[model samples]
Target: MSGDPADEQLVRQAQGGSRAAFDMLVLKYQRRVERLLSRSVRDPADVADLCQETFLAAYRALPGFRGESAFYTWLYRIAVNIAKRHRARQRPLESLEDGEGTFGTDAAPSDDATPEALLANRQLVRGLDEAVQALAEDQRRALLLREVDGLSYDEIADLMDCPPGTVRSRIFRARESLSARLRPLLEGRGGRRW
Candidate 1:
C-alpha cells in the first residue's frame, strides 16, 4: 500500500464504495490517460473511447487493487493495455518507412525552405523513427517513457517494475543505439545532431 498518501486515501475511500472519490481520481488522471492512449491510437474519437474504457475497467477493479504500485502506475497499465488492444484491432503499428507520417520531429518545415531541405528533414525524421523502432522492446519502452512522456527515472522504474538504475541503463543503451544508427544521417547533414 505504498503510494501518494492522497491517492492511497482516495483508493481506500473508493474501495469502501465511494464513487465520488473514484470520480476525483478519474478527473485528475483523465488527461494523462488520454495522452498516453493517443500515442498508439491515432483517432481522437478512438482515443476518447479507450480513455473511458480504461477508467471503467479501473473502477471495476478498484476493490481488488492492493496498492502494490502507485495508483497512477496501475492506471497507466490499464490504459496501455486498452490502447494495445485497440491498436491490434485497428491495424498494425505504422512504420516510418511507410512515408505516411513522421515519428520524432513533427514540426513542419519553414515556409522558405527549399524542396531539398524539406526532403532532408523528412529523411532525418524517418531515420530517427527507424532507429527507434529497431531498439529492443525494453529499451524502446524505457526511452519513450523518459524522453517522450517526460517521466522521471523513478516514475519510469515504478511503471516498468524495475530499479531506477535499470531504467537509466536501458535509456542509456537505447540512446547509444540510436546515436550509432543515426550517425551517418547526421554526419551527412553537416554533423548536426537532432
Candidate 2:
C-alpha cells in the first residue's frame, strides 16, 4: 500500500459517503481556494463566504466527479465559477444619470483610474514580463504552459518533450525567480490588493 494516501484516494473515500475524507480534502485546499478568491474579491468577509460556498458546491457535486482531471483541478474550476458568480452579484450599482450603466461595469471602468494606481499596475505588468523573459528558456516555457495556458504537468511534459518531474521543477524555479524580482516593488503596498 502507498505510504501516503493520494488525493484520488481521499476523493474516492469522500464519494463513498465518508465525511471525514471530504473534510480532509477541504482542509488541504481551503487556503488555495481563499487565495484564488482573494484575487477577485477585495473584501475579506466576502472571500470567506465565497470560499465556504465553493466547498459546499464541491461537496454537492462530488458524486458526479469522474476523475478525468485531478481533484484539485476540478475543485479549482468550481472555486473560479463561484468567484465569478459572486463578482457578478456584487457588481457596483450605477447611478440613474449614468446612461451607459451595465452589469459588468467593473471591467469597463465606470470612472477613471487614479494616476498612481494606473502607474503601479503598469509597472507591475512590466516587471512581471521582464522577470518571465529573464527565466531560462525551459523554465519560461514551463511556467507559461502551467500558469498562462493552465496546462497540467503531464500535458506540458508532452508538449515540451520533458518528464513531468522536470516540468514541475522548472515551474517552481521560475516562480521563485519571478517572486524574488517582484518582491521589492510589491512591499508595503498591499500587493495583492492591486
Candidate 3:
C-alpha cells in the first residue's frame, strides 16, 4: 500500500475485503508483471500462469502487507520468487528455441533508413541478445532490472535479497561480459565503443 496514492487506497480497500479494488490493481499492473515474467520465463503460457499466481499470492497476503515499499516493488518480489520456483521445477536439459531473443534493439530503424542500416541494427540486436543470454543468471537478472526496468540498486538489492554492492558488482560484470561479447560486432561500425 505504499505506491501511488490510488494504489494505496485500492490496497486498503482490498484489505478491507473489497474484491473490485484488488481487480483494479491487477488490471493496472497485469501487463508490467507479465513483461517481467517474460524476461525469465520463455513460455508465454507459463508466464501467464505465473502472473496469475503472483496476483493470487498478493491478494492472499494483502492483509499483512505493510506500507514499507512501493506496491509494484512488493509485487515484483512475489513475481520473481514465483518465476524462480517455476524455473527450479523445469528440466535442465530442455532445449531452447533458436533466435528467441529476449533483449531488444536499442533503436528501431526508421522506414526511410537504408537497408544496410536496418541489417546492421538487426545484427547488433541479435548479438546483444545472445550475449545477454550467455551471462550468469544473477548477472543477467541484475543487468536487466537496472538497465531495462530502470530500477534503483536499492530496489534491486531488495528484490534480489543482496547488498547494493553485490547488485552493483553483478551489473558491472554483466556489462563487461556483454561488452566483450559484442565488441567484435560493434567494431565494424567505425570503431564505436559499446
Candidate 4:
C-alpha cells in the first residue's frame, strides 16, 4: 500500500493533470477496476471498456475529490458506476434457456471434474461459472466485493454508496444464485467446484 503521504502527493498531481501521475494511479488501481468490471459486465471486452471508462472518469473528477473517502474507495466507486453504465447501455445476457454459454474468464480446463465422465463434469463446472457471470449486476458486484476483494459489508457499502443492508442482501442473492447453479457439480464426491 502506498503511504498516506504518497497517496496524497499522487492525488494532488493527478488533479493537476500530471499525465504520468495519473497513469501511475491507473496502474495502482487497475486490478480493482478490472474486478469490478468483471462482476458487473460479464464480457471480457466490456470489462476492458469499463476499466478505461473508470480511469477516465476518475481523471475528470479528480480535481474536486475530497479526502472524505480513501482514494481507492473513491476509485472503486467510479469503477462500479462505469460498470453499471456499461451494463445498462448494453443488452443483457440471454437466459440460461436461451443457449448462451460461458461466463467471466476461464482457466484451462483441468481434471477436477468427475473422474467417471470427465467431459460431463467439465461441462457442469463451465455451466456454473456461466451462471455466476450471468448474475444480476448488483448481486455480482456485492459478491465479488466480498469474495474477491475481501471487503467488509460496510466497506462494500461505502464503495457502492449504498446501505450495508443492501450490500448484505446482494451477497445473499449472489450466493444463492451460485449455489443453485453449482449444486449438481458439488453433489459429486469430488466435493468442491471453483
Task: For residues 1-194, write the lDDT of model 3, one tens digit per residue.
Answer: 44589999998899999999999999999998998998878788999999999999999999999978788889998998999899899975322354455765546668798989888888888888878878998998899988888899988887787999999999999999998888898888875656
1 or 3, greater by lDDT: 3
Kindly report which residue stretches of model 3 are placed more than 4 angstroms away from their true locations once superposed: 1-3, 92-98, 104-109, 112-117
Q: Write the per-residue lDDT of candidate 2 for residues 1-194, one digit (tens) a residue.
A: 21125888999899999999999999998987887676456666998999999999999999999876667767777887898788778765322223211111223322677878766655666667667657896897688767755778987776566689999999988888988888877884665422
Better of 1 and 2 by TM-score: 1
In TM-score terms, candidate 2 sits at 0.51
Predicted structure 4: lDDT = 0.73
TM-score of each: 0.82, 0.51, 0.82, 0.72
Predictions in order: lDDT: 0.85, 0.74, 0.86, 0.73
lDDT of model 2, residue 182: 86
Residue 16 error, candidate 3, Å: 1.0
Best candidate, lDDT-wise?
3
Better of 3 and 4 by TM-score: 3
Q: What would the TM-score be for candidate 3 when compared with the true structure? A: 0.82
Residues 1-194, model 4: lDDT tens digits = 23257777888887777999888888888987787666545566777877888888888888889777778888877786676677678786653433333342244556564466665555675676577677886787678778878999988887788999999999888888888787777777366645
